[model samples]
Target: MPDIVNHTFENMSTAQPHYDVIIAGAGPVGLFLACELALERCAVLVLEQAADPDSPLKRMPFGLRGLSAPSIGALHRRGLLDALDLHQRMKNPFVGPSSPGAKRPAGHFAGLVFHHEDIDMSQWPDQPDGLPASLLSEMAELETVLARRACELGVTIRRGAAIAGFDQEPDRVTVHAGDETFVGGWLVGCDGARSIVRKAGGFDFAGTEPEFTGYTFSAELSGAAALKPGRNVTARGMYLQSQPGFIVLQAFDGGAFHDAGLPVTREHLQDVLRRISGSDVTIETLHLATTWTDRARQATAYRNGRVLLAGDAAHIHSPLGGQGLNLGLGDALNLGWKLAATVQGRASEGLLDTYQAERHPLGARVLDWSRAQVALMRPDPGARALRAIVGDLMATRDGATYVAGRVWGLGTAAVRIA
Candidate 1:
């Protein structure tokens, strides 16, 4: 890795600071991309709107994210995998049926458990035996590790500096953040779903509406025994009690409750739980709660002039199979080297354009994968019938292997620079 602090550019204005790349959002994707660019000796600056990165939602239970094979490989290749200790401290949080001699659950699809024994490793000859298919990670912890690495590589990060907007010229991009302005050769948006850069850049976002409003919360329950352990797909919707207090629910309300932007009150959660679970389980106290929906969307174009989008800014879907983070990380990994090469005047003709060419279709597939899960999880008789059929298929060796490949991103094509 090259240190970018002392790097100098010839014939560049010295009156004000100018970075090779200006990235929006200090989340994992942005920071990781910064580290990648800095590794290639490109000066990078990351701007974040949030003053504090710490949030309860970024901790245990709610912050839990699964690292796909590509994500793990990326980290390992960058030597950052050793810095993450969360996987060692915590076991897999996804719970399923437990019996004395039953196979251990590896992962799930729409609350359907796929055991480790069912996944035929012989089919995936490319993946080595020792390498993990997936690993559990916390969002805050992952961000901390990436941010630390980014700073070590001389990437400048500005908190409390949200990108109000930016104007792109032929040679450079002028960004407006707070009362200050910064100039960069290029800008990338990692600012999440509600990205100012994507909107300002005029990228067309097109997708389907949500099927249900999902809830993840930690609360004290009076009659918790009424709710079964692991995931239960009732006639109404889906509910999973991963632990004693931590609960996840999918209410097929057509995303009304989440889209309404109402606070998750204890009364409201209790009502939703009762209706979905068909149980009189009382939420005694609400500790923490957040809402999401299966509303899948993707930007029609990832790049608009000097502006580019990555992570949630580029695409968003349900967190059903935990592919969002991995997909975003993959985008950062794929774009970082290409963009850095372009910024350094080392890229061949149209090299930077390949970023979207490769990533956009992959993103679209993940969106459809989430949408399919939403379709299967629908609270209808047809969906239930399909779910049963899919469940049976998932139990087979070939089917389990195929689903694992998709879930772990093992089937993603490797793009190599000539």
Candidate 2:
């Protein structure tokens, strides 16, 4: 059984309901943080803007996310790893060589495939044998597991309560969400890239603009066979036909389409696909689609007085190597215990300040990493030459090992808080 805090204030109607921490956004990071704090006997309330958790984008190929070694280890330590079952049934869609004797595809760097046999396990001696360096998980399922765990730990979750604004006092933060108000000792913004808390708190979000607007969609296509099976880097842009109906394309449009907020109609996608793939692919029926860019940004400071930031609220980068989720999870794990210790009055002075000190550097590194990929993925001649050189290096043992380490998050310095 989980250790839960029994608050006496619930019986007092005259007093305002106060919690140890109020977290904005019920994403995996927020929910996982809630579970962490509640495990340490802290009262946590998570406020989420979304009313319903179900969304088509959170279901299948669109919802697919890669869990790195650090993230997997954190889940295992918390005993939440076994609850995830999607990996058991779903095979990795990212495939490599099909030759009978060739090594299987493990992961990729800038869409360049790396095989499992190429990775030197000896380099990662700390990672035990049979333990997966990475695993594929659906966003919806991961959230469900985290939300369940948070609830089990006695964390209160209020859905459909978007944080309109918040006022941070020396002792408490009063959050205005929808038509209701909530007061807590500390406020954490785990809300995504466009976090209201970050903006309202006046965090300096700094970084590079996007080079291109990428598209991921599911649609019925004619002449689908013209597209390649795996990731294809073309003269115009990059495109990947993961399955018959599922396709991903990157058009070097300087993020104009996405920024303009134009609807992703069948005509637009078909046009983009034709140009990027250089094929006359007709989109018979567009099913699901979403647009994203490689815009990299990070908060100069993760905290302002009593308000704090986590997940995409703290930093954002392209989903090039799928490092954003892992980075956010790392932030929650690093912050949870420290914040709980502070709230419980057991932490030494200046412990909470260390959250940004440790996490900011890591976040900056990830942003640069994504930026590097964007540079390599550009359609220009310089980028193509760089890609050739990088590809040659990636084929080597040392190169593969280094890339694998970064991709699997083994290269990151572990922040162990006991």
Which candidate leads the pack in lDDT?
A: 1
List runs of model 1 lying over 4 Å from the truth.
Answer: 1-16, 89-91, 415-418
**How displaced is residue 17 in candidate 1, in Å?**
0.3
- Write down the RMSD of all candidates, one decimal each: 4.1, 3.6
Local error of candidate 2 at 254, Å?
A: 1.0
Prediction-by-prediction clash tally: 0, 0
CA shift of 263, model 1, Å: 1.6
Instruction: State the lDDT at 86 in candidate 2.
Output: 47
Which residue runs does candidate 2 get wrong by more than 4 Å?
Answer: 1-16, 89-91, 95-97
- Residue lDDT tens for model 2, 1-418: 1232222222323444899999999899999899989989999988888876667887867578889889988888888888887457334575523678777777888888777788887887888565588998888888888988888889888776778999989999999876668899999999999999999999999998988999999898899878888788888999977678898889998988989899999999999999998899899999999999988999999999889999999998888888899999999999999999999999999999999999999999999989988888899899999999998998888888899899999988885634
Model 1 clashing-pair count: 0
- lDDT of candidate 2 at residue 392, scale 0 to 100: 90
